[model samples]
Target: MRVGSTMLVRQNLTRKLSRSILLVICIGIAFFVFGVLSSFRAGFEGSEANSERLVVASKIGGNETLPLRYFQQLGGMDEIAEVTHVTRLRAHTAGNERNIIGANAVDAQSYASVYADTYDFNAEIMQAFQADRTATLVGRQLAEREGWAVGDRVNLTSFVHMTQDASRDWSFVIAGLLDGAEPTVDTNFLIVRYDYFNAALLRNQDQVNLFGIKPAVGTDINVLAETIDMTFANSTAQTRTQSETAFMSAFLEQFADVALIVKLIVSVSFGTILLIVANTMIFAIRERTLEIGVLKVLGFSGSSIMRIILTETLVLFAAGLALGFALTAAVIPVLGDALSSVVPDLYLTPKVVATSVGLAVVFAVLTGFLPAIKALRLPVATALNHR
Candidate 1:
């Protein structure tokens, strides 16, 4: 298009400044939501999909405890390099109901071996933890939140388990502060010795909620996951084994279908903005029929009319898309802090940016085509009749 025509298009877009700004804000909200949700998915999927470790749980449900013997059976497999088991229970200080948190009863040695790459607690902490039957290691976040310190003797009430004393209360000395290597890695939980937990239980003795396993180097994780499940397929306690991340995803899914919710919100937002921008432009074109007639009379071709209309639409989308993504980038860190318990590394990613840009282009074409075609096909006399 000529410089004169470019100037005309800009004038037409800004003819009603308020409408243009409103449409741009509508589009911006859509893309901002899309960008944020895409980052959330990328954060979870990127970190969890390629992990080599596996989890084995009862077919009934991961929360249901399986025989502790499954731990030994998994460890004996040639494809498995290490194994550990844990059962979790919700706990709070005896007098503090609002402070309720979950604690894991774990085998320290086997757990450290299996999870060395994932967990980053102090080595010295384990010595004190192993030496005391009722010792607990408090995660840094949990300790700070609850005002706990090493050597502090605390009594906790378990919501799920009962002790041989016919009560839910358990006693522990805080052996040390457990910590994670990364700021986003969750260090807001508790860990206790499996032996102490088991010996004190009133029922469901010799059981674990799930087992963690590491595949031997070069062993295919999928093959090992299937083999582990098949071994117990016909047993009294059948197993369902999958990647560690898959298990966590399944657990999170119980609380809410996060992926589905994010997708639904984004889809609705994009669909709403597409229709809004299309209808608004349609009316704007109808109102400008006389001006289009004047332009055609001045020797502007149908192709030029089409180009100018489409260019106007592209400009609006360009502004909106840039503003939306800018907000997404600015808000990602803040959202990550809020959701740190769930998504560890939420942020704008290159893949999400590329995808959003591509989607916006397609949406712009679809939204603009009808109005532009209406202008392109308008005969000079017919458009002039509007005068």
Candidate 2:
């Protein structure tokens, strides 16, 4: 096998350097696209799967606000383990002038109790946030990016000006950091006490965008969701509730059908690779017609000829796969930073790497099969006389 590979490398790749190089480039690009899409989907679905939480939003739409009274009502339900409400604030930091980062005003004690399963709150920080209305807790990612430490004061410019004065900037003391329980949990939110926000921005008082719910274990989550919706049915402010996974799917569907988009992209990429690789293989075999005849005359079996061709095609794919995956690994961090709000996190996991290698093997078989068949059946005399 080693001797056969040496022969193929010398007579095929070395002699046809231009064709080989072009094929490698094309294969690299195709696989790179596949790796990116797979990583995005994995990050999104993985986060949703481990969470058993539910979200209660206004029936009117996502942007509509719900009354603060709903928090008490939701908490009163026996099926719910915990409930908390939060209002979204528009805020931007230095150097991110164009991007509107998400900040939330949450009830410090209640919010901590609800998210305890997914996040660990420092006891001292929690005490500070509850004790001082101006105190805030930063997500791990935001703290690392902004170089914020305990007791550091940070000011955020809000889009909504305060009613008391036309001031847009709000300042807070960093009391603590919210650390994620798992890698999939998003740690980019800047959570502040709602009392301070409501008192500061008197214009938008006693209103929250959504309620987060945690159901008691052994409780039927879907049934509880239906019950919550039914309780508020046709009221002045109707409510809609869904599991975390369902809500994420619905939210992502607003942009595009994720499954359909993935299918179209993978299909197009592989189709292009199939044509490019097949042409390269056929040309390489045709150029080596006389060499193949000599091999057969020297007692090489037809199966051995087929093995040589298949092995050569696989080597080309392996080279491209290595380059493509390395490129994907390098690009993941930049992509994650740019799309942090949407993607949350991007990773090139071992499962994804294994899947890409399996795809390369499949490509090898498809591209090399027809050419190998031709080489196997060629008459030694006829092949020797070819131009």
Candidate 3:
């Protein structure tokens, strides 16, 4: 057979078809795990774009309320500008005891302006909502869940807030639906007007659960957060302020360093597979020792033998990675839909694809190098006289 013939490589692979297929399956499983884990880590990391903003909550506890007057103190500071606050309410619709809603009472202008990049809002619809105090912006997912539409009047019963008459009942007009700019964003809640909700409440009327802050154009967020916290350091309503990214990172870290865990898992899997692949290549080339000697006698160079062995390894890697990534692409969207709350936007990213491809090339070289070298160094007389 011609030394450089494609038939030579094909024959070598098919001579042990089941072993080759098994190796490919092993590689495919590794890449699939890597892709899924990488995407999972990305989803848990949350949006990095909103890192510039800050969230200031009461230092007393995670769910403790903050005084509404803190907004004025925070907004008047040089570093802090355009402060927005949220008064959270836990509520469910009348007659439907099953679905609970995480609702917030916010000022329309400040809230929308602060979260402009996070949410997709219509100008006309916001204007209508602003014009009516009873209007609420229901998240698209929540709206769909409750089968609600624009202009639909929703009677809500609050679990926290009570009316002046000691009733938990409140009503709202569905002014519009909320949409997210990011697919991973959880749009399963609603927001009502602060003025209207506070006025109706019998207790804790002038309190806010969270504060959203925009720093001055050139201000450092860490410095800004420090300044804000220090301003109320000696006061009754002390605060814990952090950048949006820091807040999310802290929340995720409460469980574990998930990204690190993913890396460790992938590393172990790839290491095990690497040894398997390299060992298999060595044995396969050893089996072709006598054939290689015949090829040399037929005038084929050692360089040509090297190319054949390396090329076969690459072919195995290419087929395996292709299958693995294709499976990953198919599985991600289904996972995103099923576990939206746990892992949102679970699709493969360009960085991940590039990383996977780069790693594959390096690993393929590592697997093929020793075997290819042995083939290249095998003297024609020695190979021919061998068993």
Residues 1-387 of candidate 2: C-alpha lDDT, one tens digit per residue: 767457765567667778777788788888788888888876655463434788898888777889999999999999999899988877886346665656899987778778887888768778878888888899887788678898898788777636347677778888888788776677777898898888888476898988889898888888999999999996899998988777767657767878578769988998999898998899889988998998899988878889888987888898889888988898988898877766776778677889999999999899999899999999999988988
Q: Write the per-residue lDDT of candidate 3 for residues 1-387, one digit (tens) a residue.
A: 255477778888888999999999988888999888888887777643378999998887547899999888887888866789998787777767555676899988888878887888779769888989999998887787678999999888888789899999889999999889776566777899999999989999899988999888999999888888898899998999988877766657768988779989999999999999999999999999999999899987888878888878888888889988998999998887776656544678877788889888888889999999999999999999978
Highest lDDT: which candidate? Answer: 1
Predicted candidate 1, C-alpha RMSD: 3.8
Question: Candidate 1: minimum summed lDDT over ten consecutive residues — where?
Answer: 42-51
Ranking 1 against 2 by lDDT, winner: 1
Put the candidates in TM-score order, highest first: 1, 2, 3
After superposition of all CA atoms, the RMSD between model 2 and the true structure is 3.8
In terms of lDDT, the poorest run of 10 residues in model 2 is 42-51
| Number of residue pairs clashing in candidate 2, backbone atoms closer than 3 angstroms, sequence gap of 3 or more or interchain | 0
Candidate 3 accuracy as TM-score: 0.80
The parts of candidate 2 lying over 4 Å away from their true place are 1-15, 37-51, 94-99, 160-168, 183-185, 219-224, 252-267, 289-304, 334-344, 373-387
User: Could you tell me the C-alpha RMSD of candidate 3 in Å?
Assistant: 3.9
Clashes of 1: 0
For each candidate in turn, the TM-score is 0.81, 0.80, 0.80
